[model samples]
Every structure is written in C-alpha cells, then in structure tokens.
Target: MVSVRDDATMREALTAGQSGALADAYDLYAAAVYGIAVRITNDHGAAEDVTQEVFVELWQRPERYDPGQAPLRGWLCMIARRRAIDWRRRQVTRDRYTLLLAGQALPAPNVEEDVEASTMAKLVRAAVHDLPPLYREAIALAYFYGLTYREVAVQLGIPEGTAKYRLRTGLRRIGDSMSSVRAE
Candidate 1:
C-alpha cells in the first residue's frame, strides 16, 4: 500500500501513474466528495453517479489537479458539486421536453363523436350535391379544392364577382337544407 501522507505526495504518486495512489486518493476523499454531491443533488442515485464521474475524471486527467492551488479534498468536492448540479439541469431539461411532447401529442379518438361528425359530413356532402350545377361547381372549386375566389373565377371562366355570388348563394342553400333536416 502506498502511504499518501499529504496532498503533495498524493500528487506526486498520481503524476507517476501509480494505480495504488489512485486507490489511496479515493479512500481519502470519496466520502467527502459523495457528501458534497448528495448535499447538492439531494438524490442518492444521482449523487452516486456524480461521485463516480468525479473519480473517473480524476483518474483520466491527473495532471489537471494542482496541490499548490487547492487541497485534494476541496478539488474533489468542487468537481462533485459541479457534476451534481449539471445532472440536475439535464433532468430538468428532459422533464420539460417530455411534458411539451405530451402536450402536443394527438388525443385518442372518441367513437361516438367520430360517428356523429362523419354522419354530419356525409349529410352536408349530399346537400352540396343537390345544389344547382352552377352553384355546386363554384362551391366545390372554392371550398373543397381550397381555391381562392379569384382562382375559382379563373378556373370556371367566370367573372370574380359572379364567382363570389355563386359561392354565397350555394352556402346559403346548404345551410337551409341542413336547417330543414334538423327541424324534421
């Protein structure tokens, strides 16, 4: 067992790439790092992840630590705290995205409502079909085909004012038909 008496010795041993020094460093500072992580994150699982990440970072980049700047315990605690806070931020962002996606998702279909709406649409289509040929053509061109009034006029070879008048008259006739059906 390598005896890590002080931070300087630990640094020297770590710089020399001794695995025993890493074990010794972990033994000395793991509890303090974990404590800081738990305090910051307030979650046991997240704290454990943060603790593991701190040690992995230390093992991967031993040269990053300078004993002249700070003690090993303080450095490890700082890393743990930062990792914990970052984990919390990531969790918050993930939860927000989940909620946003849920809000935007399509709702399940209602059988009765779907049936009623489909029946009403069929009735309206029948009424439109019963309209006079001139009005039926204009309404189908402007509404069903999503054409503007000017486009409908151009397509049907009629004046724009004539197209508008046909559309209005056609809609009124459909409304009257639907009203009569409802009354019966």
Candidate 2:
C-alpha cells in the first residue's frame, strides 16, 4: 500500500495547482501512459495525443482522483484508458458517419444491426476503457490493431505473460460489454 505521506504529497502537489508538480507527476508516469496509448492506437501520433490529454486531464480535474482508493499510478492508468477508448469511439463514429453520408452502403444494416453496432461499439469501448491500462492496451494492440502478443509486450516493455493477461482480461471485458448491449 502506498503510504499516506506519499498520497498526501501527491494530493498537495495537485491541489496546490503547481505546474511543476504536474510535470513531475507526468515524468513519473509518462512512459506507462504512453505505452498504454501506443498499445491501443498503434500510432505514435495518437499515443502522444493521448499522453498529453492524460496529463492535461490530471491537471484539470485532480479532484476526481482519490488516493485512498487507488495509487497514483493506477489513477493515471485509469484516466489513460478512458481517454484512449474515447478517442477510438469518436474516431469510429466519425468514420462510420462519414462513410454512410457518402452514400456507400456496404451492407444493409437493419435497424438492429445498425444500432447494435454503434451502441455496442460504444459500450465495448467504454468497458475496455475502464479496464486497467495495461490490459486495455494489450487487448487493443492484439485485437484492434492486429499486433501479436509478443509485439505488444515488446512495445509496452512488459513480460509476455503480463501482456497475455491484459489481452485476456480486455477480451473478457469487451465480450461482457457486447452481451450487455445485445441484451438491451
């Protein structure tokens, strides 16, 4: 468990609105956050954006963090997952909408399929988003970005088992989310 003093230090740094403190925090966690983002998007640009967004969010809404519940690392990872998932959802929605508007009906999506695809995608994204950053990133790299688990581990600087664990957990979460969406 992280000591109270450590948590207090972080909270104080954040609450004081110290820009340098935020930088210190970022330096402490940027690699992990960037690894998570890169694992998800598989694009350097997107990962960088996600990294920046995560720190910016921390700066903007430090109150959302509760040291009592999770350590600082976990909190940052959670935020990183959320931002990556949101980015994917928005990207998918925009692309799909653009394609549809362009009069390219590749498939006849019945109301159910259409709604299910979009809504389930959103829910699945959210579920994946809520996962621990490591797991979320592993799953994103393997399934979403078509990378091998070995590649994921290499990219994230984690062991192969860890990468596989994240992939499994992420897939389970996505499956659960899909089922929930279908039931709705």
Candidate 3:
C-alpha cells in the first residue's frame, strides 16, 4: 500500500495508469468525498452515488486534476459537491413535475372526462415514443423532466439552440400525429 500522505506520488502513479494508486486514492479520499456529498445532498444513497461518480471521474480522467492547482482531496471534494448538487437539482425537478402531474384538477370527476384524459395521455406517450431518439430525448428532458431548454442542452451536451430546435420540431410532430389520430 502506498503512503496516503504522498498525494503527488499517488497522482503520478495514477496518471501512469497504476490501478493500485486508484485504490489508494479511494482509501484516502472516499470518506471525505462521501461526507461532502452527504452534506450537500442530505441523502445517503445520493451521496454514495455522488461519491462513486467522483471516484469514477478521477479514474477515467486523472489528468483533470492538477496537483499544482489543488490538493487531491480538495479536487475530489469539489467534484463530490458538484455531483451532489446536480443530483439534488434533478430530484427537485422530478418532484415538482410529479406533484404537478398528480395535483392537476380533474374535470368535475366525470367518467367521460377521465376516459378522454387517459386516451389523450396514451396518444401523447405513443407519439413521444415514435419520435426520433434525439427529438424524443430533447422533448422528454424539457417537458417531462421539467428542465428548461438550457438545462436540456446542458444535459444532452448540445447547444441551447439545438435543444430548442429539437423540442420545437418534436412537439410539432407529436401535434400532427395527434391531429391525425383525432381525425381518424
């Protein structure tokens, strides 16, 4: 086992593709990373996920950390913090949408209205499923996931304009499909 005190040597070993260095780094930093993630996320499961993500990122891209810029622990903590916050943001968005969908006021509790709503929802889901992969992803992220176009762009790693375009185009196709379904 490498000495945990020698971060520079550990980083060097990691950069040189040494697997033992990664295990040593995890031993030295996992608790600190998990602590930061739990503090930010307030969820043990999410904190564990964030901690795992931080370590996996470090393993995949060891060069992203410059020991000259920051200590390894600090770098790992920062990554954990960011991942935890992102996880929290996604959770908030999901909860908000779930509540919004659940709390929608029904139309006087009529059987006809309920049937229509169910049918429409099924049609929309079918249309969404029929969309191209990129369009479907954009629509799902923007509408179903309650993300703004910019957020969808960031999540999809696309430009904001592209996200907007895909969303617009996708919704138009879904609308057209619904129109045809209604006509039939």
| Best model per lDDT | 3
- For each candidate, what is the lDDT? 0.81, 0.76, 0.83
Candidate 2 regions with alpha-carbon error over 4 angstroms: 1-5, 107-184
Q: What is the lDDT of residue 175 in candidate 1?
A: 99
Q: Point out where model 1 deviates above 4 Å.
A: 1-5, 104-184
Return the lDDT, model 1, position 90: 92
Candidate 3 yields a Cα-based lDDT of 0.83
TM-scores, all candidates, are 0.53, 0.55, 0.55
lDDT digits (tens) for residues 75-128 of candidate 1: 777788789889888987787778778896544558999899998999899999
Better of 1 and 3 by lDDT: 3
The window of 10 residues in a row where model 3 has the poorest summed lDDT is 140-149
Residues 101-125, candidate 3: write the lDDT tens digits.
9996433437888899999999999
- Model with the higher TM-score, candidate 1 or 3: 3
In terms of TM-score, which candidate is strongest? 2
The residue-level lDDT of candidate 1 at 37 comes to 80
What total of clashing residue pairs does each candidate reach?
A: 0, 0, 0
Descending-lDDT candidate ranking: 3, 1, 2
RMSD, every candidate, angstroms: 27.8, 9.2, 13.6
